[model samples]
Target: MTKITIPLDNPTLDDVARHADVSPATVSRFMNNPSIVSERSKRKIEESIRELSYVPHAAARTLASKKSRMIGVVVPSLDDALFGHFLELFHSHISTEGYTTVVASSGYSSDEEHIQITQMVSHGVDALLLVGLARDESVYSLLNKKKIPYAITWATDDLGEHSCVGFSNHDAAVKITEYLMDLGHRQFAMISGTLKGNDRASNRLQGVRDALARRELSLPDELVIEGPIGIEHGQKAFKLLMSRSPRPTVIVCGADPLAYGAIFESKVLGVEVPQDVSITGFDDTWLAAHLTPSLTTLRTPQQQMSLLSAEYLIAKLKGEDVDVPPTLGVDLVVRESCSSPA
Candidate 1:
């Protein structure tokens, strides 16, 4: 059994052309614009690419065509499966149109996000997909100055002067809270993601507050727990809320992971879900439906948002007259985890 080994140095376009028995110019044309290449040449080049495992130098291609054929995406964190799903959909949609995605995480910091954005731009990303429209003013300015076609995801703020492909976090939260209120839940507590630099988290918190205010209820300082990302943080926050003298009959988590943790912690504390307390979460992730008591959550249109954002950016890159991307909506998924408070 003989093993085929590729050269230590990368295979170049010239090598692919040689293997394909075509001129280097023909090979370049086939790569840059395959539609212009003849069928026979296309087949040959593709076969050569597969046989040699030839990878194009993005930098060289960008220099020749003035198009990087790359899209940059910066999200707050990748720990959430929701973000992973979004990336998967976004990547799949754009890949069909000859674009690749590069992703970076900001750890939920605006400054860090700014740096990542700058780095992506410097590396010659054709466009950017940002999580939200709450970054530093300079970041926006930088995009404008560079004339980069970028879109915001996970939030739809039409008031902002940018293209966005997401739903209103505030409205989704309101829907969840209102539903709980309708279920006769008055004593409410919240386990929220850190709102310091996250507009999504801040908006969600405000949504809960606004809904409570409309019902002549209030979210007391003690009932609100600002938590970091993860199940452990959710567990700790739940414990703190449950420790209150008059424990909340209902707990609203900013995301599903927190709600999952809360449910687990409830069992540990000998509290029955929906009997002693009702719990609700945002982002109807895959796990939400399979929990012991299926979680009541907001079903965000993550796939739709990602697909539209990718398409919008690609269209804009092609000098198309792209309109402001439509704001997708969320659905309220009522499940076993939430019920009338006892």
Candidate 2:
């Protein structure tokens, strides 16, 4: 076997073109699709590449293919486990197909979401994975203009006509509430994530209201408190809810981190969970099951979402047809945190 000599310096496509005595565009075509180039040029370019050890620029080659093979994911926040789980599963799935995920946190801001999306598009992401379906019309318009494919995960919109995976936040909230109501809970309060510019949080609040309305019960303006996703905010919201005379028999949280805050705050206040009051949360995070009183929460189909999202985008890239489920389902995981009010 003959050993090959190594080049001291990196050789670019132009160097290969020069060595091959061909145009740079011809070298590019040879690199991207050898079938498009003449046999003589292809043979010369291959020989030149071997002699110079010329490496094709990945970005330039991808540009020629019109596929970055990168999927952009923008979530409300990267700090939350709900999004973390979704991403973990998503990465595991999407990576198998030779796609890389570039993640960004919107910090629960619509404007930030738009900015992240635009930046991803500018960077040549082949597709996008967003958390929810509700965003500015301009965002959708921009995506349309760019001809970029996208999938919405975690929340579904019936009228949006967008590719979506995951369950209905509104329906899940209703189920959680109905579960508590079935447990003989009447007085209710909610600690929800910030509603503005977030369809997931707003739909959860509306779900609770709809559930309450079904039983001739109502969530007064004071019964619901909106704050950002965090344990600290949940604690503050829980404290405020508990301070009122005759504490609400049940408190439903929009996400598990918020529930964690509520439960910890309840312990601080010397309130017995499910005895003095019941608590339920969304996004059945790992911490939920390990809490002092394990949380009753919704087990979002994160793996399913991840799988479907990857499949959907891969199909789009392959020019294959795929059937996206109208709406995915979620499981209501009952635990020690909720029971009939005494």
Please report the candidate that would top lDDT against the real structure: 1
TM-score on alpha carbons, each prediction:
0.92, 0.85
Which tens-of-lDDT digit does each residue in 38-147 have in candidate 2? Answer: 88988888898889877666687686687777899998888877788788888888775657799999998888898999999999998898988668888888888998
Question: Candidate 2: lDDT over CA atoms?
Answer: 0.86
Candidate 1, poorest ten consecutive residues by summed lDDT: 1-10
Give the C-alpha miss distance for residue 81 in model 1, angstroms: 1.3
- Reference-based TM-score, model 2: 0.85
Worst 10 residues of 2 by lDDT: 1-10
Error of 1 at 56 (Å): 1.8
